[model samples]
Target chain A: MTSDSRLSWRDVRDRIHEHILTGRYGPGDRLPRDADIAEELGCARSTVQRAMQDLSDSGLVERRRKGGTRVRAEPVTRATLDIPITRREVEQSGARYGYQLIRRRMAPAPRGVVAAFGLGASRPMLRVEALHLSDGRPYIFEDRWICPETSPEVNDLDFTEESANEWLVLNKPYTRLDLRFYAVSANPRLSDLLETEPGAALLVIERTTWVDDAPITTVKAITTPGYQLLTGS
Target chain B: MTSDSRLSWRDVRDRIHEHILTGRYGPGDRLPRDADIAEELGCARSTVQRAMQDLSDSGLVERRRKGGTRVRAEPVTRATLDIPITRREVEQSGARYGYQLIRRRMAPAPRGVVAAFGLGASRPMLRVEALHLSDGRPYIFEDRWICPETSPEVNDLDFTEESANEWLVLNKPYTRLDLRFYAVSANPRLSDLLETEPGAALLVIERTTWVDDAPITTVKAITTPGYQLLTGS
Candidate 1:
């Protein structure tokens, strides 16, 4: 597209970002009003507003109610991560997905589970331990706890046919989600379960969900060695 | 916040979300047009539109240009992660921040770096290794490769006083970013540098950036044990 061509919001955002990258607008420098930018670029003011909103969302700029927009002094690299159901993840990778339920029982919530849910006290919950396989090889071992008070239907249905990861994601809609990533050295038990050697480094993805301030579930998905989690492009 | 009070866009969103959570609107169900929902809720069409946009952004709904909106058939959990400059991250955590430059040199880009940048062939790049400290303890060890062709200013400035991580973030504005997280077993060299034991599991955050298809830099930030990366709340 030529410079004089009709500009989309992305085009407008790129032009504004070009100005900033060229040092025309230094750190913490105030940007022109949306109207002025629209006039200069021969685009609608709404287009400029959209571009500004995107830049603001990406942590490149800060927008104030009446103070206009300014470049962020400390720019942050913002990324979006989408964690899909393990079955979907494996299938999308062109692998035959398999799941096995290792154990299921009703037990008191552990201290870690209680802290994750921010519960007042420990309570009875359904605990599920399962393994996700890709092409008959171990992929991820998940330890999940379901709050029966919030999801009573889980108690009626056995997870032998389908994994809880797929069931809860399809049935329950969470208002809030908490995600964390860390690393752990696989112990002998975990190594045996994941079919990896002991002392191997593994990535752990911890996810906790809540629906309208009520606990839904908390899960720790420990992946086998060399597994990588990538952000959505 | 009574039910009959003037409703904001957030109120409209929560009401619609409650319907989905309560099974009133099942998966893959088409939502009413924005205008109809606005009239039923006694709000403006623009307000309903905003609420729908929020839902769509969070992976709860799918909005088609000509087909209108519907609940996502398979919901994915979406989260935003903001990785600020390491110095800012340390200071924001209420800890004193320190930086040390370990090595800086110009070398031929490695195979991994070339693949990260999607380059046609290997090229000479500026390689820098640095350590970020919190309260005099190693927080993160970064091994970075900067494309001198894209950033020529790096040739003049020595990264002794300020870290390349902080400097590049402030100076460079990338149009594209690639992020990956994985675990690594600390080797003897890495263990000595990070002051950790051998075979310790470490979290590695690899980031690659480009400015409009021109490669900028790629860095692998290896964190010490017990470090966790959390999603933005």
Candidate 2:
């Protein structure tokens, strides 16, 4: 209803992107104002604004409060990754989802866990070791540490019927999140747990979350060999 | 000036996000209309719209064309990843950047390359093998294939002085991109090139890009051992 023309925001965005691809607007070049662009393209200003927002979110442009929009001097390959709960992932993959709780106890946070949370010192936290399976095959081995001070409910519930991954993701909303991906060689323990050969290359995803200034949890999810993580388009 | 008060879009976003965190609106619950929320909060409807856009982008909610906005039933941990040019990445890390072109020739697209582009048949493409160095040490080994039909200018450029990674990123823009990450064990050839021990676990970042439906390029950036890719935030 905003525009009489049939041009959608996606069409406007593609047009602007074509301008950049064809060098009409080079790097660091300022683009026309939204009103000007809208007039030129015979569309509504809101349409142009939506297109500009998309370009900005994709790292193709920089928009300032009053300085207007400009092409980024250096473009990056920006990607969005969506990591779902393990059970959902397996189910969506057409596999029977299974989980096993290996170990659970309270222990002092390790040096790595402490560092991951950016804590001043180590503290007693709940440590959980679990394995996710797909079709009775080992899928991922998770080593997690939860802060009881932040979520006291964790101390009462045993993580047997439900996984900490699913529980925390649903109950605990994080204000800040840190994610990193790396590769690790499977050692004896990891090989045994994952049912893979020793020295097999494995992909590792480490995640740390915080609510305001309080650390919630930090986890390292190590996958079996040949597992690949893909971007969500 | 949208709001008479000092509330910004981020303030509105956090306030609404807090509602979700406190269980005021559970998963799959529809939110109040933007105008209603704006009236309640004494802010402009556009402010609420911006907040809802952010929440939707972060996968916390879903907005429909006419159904309004609702909390996502299945929540996902969404992260944004920004991969800069190899040269810029090294320079930003305060290291001297180096590049080496191992080989450059025209070859038939391999099975993996064809599959990456979702092409039905194999065709001749420009194959470029290169190495990126940090402080004169092996950093990333890249195996790339460029579809000359999509990017004919690639046939004229020699990748000795400037890397293909930098050149393509600066010149050619893609409409679509596919990114995947996995682990690979260094074989004898990979070990010799990367100067790592055999069986060392290395992270491989595979990227395929397309302009509309035409495939632009596909590259596998094999990173050195201990290399880590982190989220932008």
Instruction: Identify the candidate with maximal DockQ.
Output: 1
For residues B1-233, what per-residue lDDT tens digits would candidate 2 score against the true structure? 54547788878888988898888989999999999999888898999998897777557888997899999988888888888999989998999999999999999999999999999999999999999999999999999999999888887899999999988886666667899999999999999999999999999999998866899899999999999999835
Q: What's the lDDT for residue A151 in model 2?
A: 92
Docking class of 1: medium
Of the true interface contacts, the fraction found in model 2 is 0.71
Q: lDDT by residue for model 1 over A86-166, one digit each (tens)?
A: 998999999999999999999999999999999989999999999999999999999999999999999887899899998
Candidate 1 ranges beyond 4 A from true positions:
A1-32, A40-42, A63-70, B1-32, B40-47, B50-54, B63-70
Report the TM-score of candidate 2, chain B only: 0.87
Candidate 1 lDDT tens digits, B9-115: 88898888888877788889999999999888988888899888778766788899689999987788888888899999999999999999999999999999999
- What C-alpha lDDT do the candidate models reach, one value each? 0.90, 0.90
Residue A35 in model 1: lDDT: 98
Give the residue spans of candidate 2 off by over 4 A: A1-30, A40-47, A50-54, A64-67, B1-29, B40-54, B64-67
TM-score of 1: 0.88
lDDT of 2 by residue, A80-180 (tens): 88889999998989999999999999999989999999999999999999999999999999999999999999999788879999989877767678999
